[model samples]
Target: MASSTKPPPVEALKPITSVSASPPRLLPTALSLPPKWLNMYSSFITANQSSVTQIESALRSLTYIIPGRFRDAELASESLHSSIQLLSMYHDTLLTRAISKLPGMPNASLHNRYTKFWIAKSKFYRRIATMLTMIQYTELLWEMMAKRKGERVRWRIIVILELVKAVCRLCLLRITNSRPLVTPALPERETIPEEEAPTEEEEVEMEEEVTPRVKEYKMKRTGLSLPTLPNPSDISSYLLSKVLTADDIKAPNTLLNKVNGSAQLAEILHIIQPVIYAIAMSRSKDKKDWQPWLLGLSIEYAARQLRKDGLRTTALEREQWGKRGWAMGWWAMRGAFYENVTKGFLQSTSERLPSLVSGVLDDYKYLWDEYYFSTSSN
Candidate 1:
């Protein structure tokens, strides 16, 4: 009886449309705008990185100007500074990735190997550097929380954070094999647009030019092709070649030679200076104790002098060191020096200055009085 029932005619049978067969529902404008805006912002940052950096720098400078006249002003300034730092970190991350994808110089030289190694190493170190920066920006917030608990807790937190930073730096030093650590950890790569990249024709021409020179070099050599010689095809051995060692891969040297042991000691001193200060502050009964200042300043000054003697720093390095020296002036706002000398000097100076200038000084003085770390330039 069932067989006798004829199958439904093909024309009568309608195809069943599953729910998924329908086109995807468009996201609401409000829901979609955030991602779109974020993409646009990211693109803008990528395109005009230098300008963005300048803006960030300017904002940071403004934070310094926006004195801690009241609790609200101090909070605002700190928030602004931290936001800028975070934004810079984000931009730097994007730039790092962009630089990573860029093609190496279109030449068969040791430079290609060096670029490859540096990019990879820089990627690893950049993460550590970013972590250190994160710790720095969040320090105030952490201290604020710890202060609610106890003074000792706050100081301990500082010590711990500083120790972590020092340990991370030590790790970086080891990674560099005692070489000078670059500030950003990521080396700056020249941004080459697609049009700027070498064309196939150019690459062919380069190969032609390079081949003859290499052949001539081989011909000039008196000895047999030694097994000890690096195979150009082997990346590890190629990088380890006399012309391009691991040290060269890690960072550039302004001078011809590698940094001496004293330079390494200087780096160590720089890394541990904050930790020494934190420990001293934690142990000291007097906030204006001279011992902490003496220890911290002595170590810092020695480090600076040793750095100068041991290595020929680049202009940028010298500038950074100079900033550290300027920061040392902050010590006058702390310790017995501040109590005995700087406080009275500032008071007298303010009295003689114009009202506006005196007001500004008073604001800064209040900040210095209220916060232990307010004078920290970094």
Candidate 2:
């Protein structure tokens, strides 16, 4: 019989690995987690955002329903609105980190690459602008409260806030090199946080998905390495190359060839108009002086026209413009215009209406007269 040597023991049959063999590639095991407390807070706030919004809306509507006789209720509603806004601002601070972690386009086209590069470059200023806006809005609420408190320093505070905002916009303009400022500065991220950490199986799936590409990338450079043209689809290499370095990404160029000088000017004027109004108010003896109204309205009208002429107004800009237009109706309440024009019109209209409708109109009129800041554009 052939000496059938039993197959080598299973352990001995195993192939020997070289001592210098490359270490196993480490794969990311899980998605990054924010601080536990922050995760919980953000998760709670984000999950209830819609409910909060609904509650706010209810509060606002309550102000309309509550008669002027209930002054405390009206003030309470206003306070709650301001409190909710402060909470929203706090949420915004946490949002920035989430936004930073978002993945970039790995296979961006030339135009996309340029856009991404500038956006990344301007990220800091954009964040500053966002913070300033939050402060401005929050301060406005406090300023209204301060006015009620008979604080002599409120005017100075308003002037300083407006000036600071103007300066921030100027810096933004300089950074963009006169490019149209993106309103809101940052895009909205998901309000809802992740409900659960990824499961082990999901993590393994993600590892499997990512590992092959990494291995392929290594395999491509394994042998006969040579200087080859950078792939246009490879965003990392493109970013590292001289192309982005040589070009001025922030140069005054139309975004998608749609923006124009008119848009830029409109944005600038829109930003500074509040400052102009604040200055006029500070100098004037009468808070509702026609001079300030004329000055503010003129600047605003010019901005609106320039924006219209640009033919490149975003939906958001258009919406804001519409809001400004509505706010202009409030101008009738300012200066002698309300005493001479609007007051008579309202009186006549209310006289003709039924008692119930007239009562509602009177409540609204009370809101208009008693709480000027409620409808103020600034």
Candidate 3:
């Protein structure tokens, strides 16, 4: 029988009440605030306390609901549902208000007061994706316990179909609502800036004056300064650590296989279209040529695999999820945790950080191993 259950009512969920957009700056010990100002600050907190409580409750509800559908699923398990619930709730209540009302927020900053909350939606999608993975696990367990012939297969197909629909809506909602708004672009190059073009006479004169000797020397020196193509090692461990590692690190081997399957791989690829574009663009001096290659490679890989495996193909079908995985990977490399980027031990926290993180993770691991060995000897 088909699963009659609907996808969770993501849209129907109530929003948290807005909080004060501008929080007061910390008072210096010597500069006592006037009695009236102190009273006003106290009153603001008191008024918003109830609203904060409600947002927390809502997030708690979301976390509770995640595993409730599966009789076997545990509420306290090491899954992303907990992180999503806590983070989203905090974001929806505290961060959202600040972003909407706070003045002097840094522009184009992802972690600035305006941008931090955007991570909430993306994190929500990650949890939802993880929960869908658990659903697959439950189905497999059901199949193993099935005594009647064909019972497992019928139910598995039904559950898989439902999951497909739920995932589609989940992705649509996430992209639409994401903070910093994840926008997808079709494969195309932007037109060159008009000002970059020079007159024919000027171009000819410049070409003649710029001797082959100077050109060769410039090229040689520039090559040394330019960065090399990124290898896997180039990705900092600190960057990787940003990917919210759920308490549930123990994905069943079966789940891992499913994740790596052709269908699943394709799905992830489609969801991460933005990241794919970014990666390809980052690689090239010109954005136009590389983007087409990136898009084409993902599409072709999925299409060919689908054809080879004879997976169902239809007009309504979206490519299976390697796109989302790519996005997740990018986030793992670039996203931050609770640590604010505004302050650091030394240097503006916003500065180029990937290399710094890479060095730290490398040294830390070696140090840890040395400590373990010394302790064991004692």
Q: Give the number of the best model, judged by lDDT.
A: 1
Cα lDDT of model 2 by residue, 1-378, tens digit? 788777778777566774357865543322334466679886665556656557756765664565565655655655666666656556655553444465651233323333344556777665776666676556646565666766456677777777887887777667666654444444433343435799999989887885433222234556554444466689687656646432234332333233357766787887798788778867787644578878987897888778643455334345445666776676667544665678679989999999988888887677665443444555
Please write out the lDDT profile of model 1 over residues 1-378, one tens digit for every residue: 566767888756665653237655665766999999988887787788777777888889887764766765566677777788777767766765666566663322223233234446576555676676687776776665666688888788878887887887787766656655544444333443444589899989887885432232243467554344445579676664436443334433331224567877898898888888879878999866789878988998888888753344444455456667777788777766787789899999999999988988898887676555666544
Clashes of each: 0, 0, 18
Task: Name the candidate, 2 or 3, with the larger lDDT value.
Answer: 2
Query: In lDDT terms, how accurate is model 1?
Result: 0.67
RMSD of each: 11.5, 18.7, 28.3
| Higher-ranked by TM-score: 1 or 2 | 1
- Residue 329 accuracy (lDDT) in model 3: 34
Which of 1 and 3 is the better model by lDDT? Answer: 1
**Candidate 2 segments whose C-alpha is farther than 4 A from its true place:** 1-34, 45-52, 59-69, 72-75, 90-123, 149-152, 181-266, 286-289, 305-333, 351-367, 370-372
Model 2, backbone clash pairs (residues 3+ apart or across chains), number: 0
lDDT of each: 0.67, 0.61, 0.37
Best by TM-score: 1
| Candidate 1 off by > 4 Å | 1-38, 46-62, 95-119, 184-260, 305-327
Using lDDT as the yardstick, the better of models 1 and 2 is 1
Tens digit of per-residue lDDT, candidate 3, span 116-205: 322343565445444444443243233323313464443444344344534643464444332111222111111111234898999899
RMSD of 1: 11.5
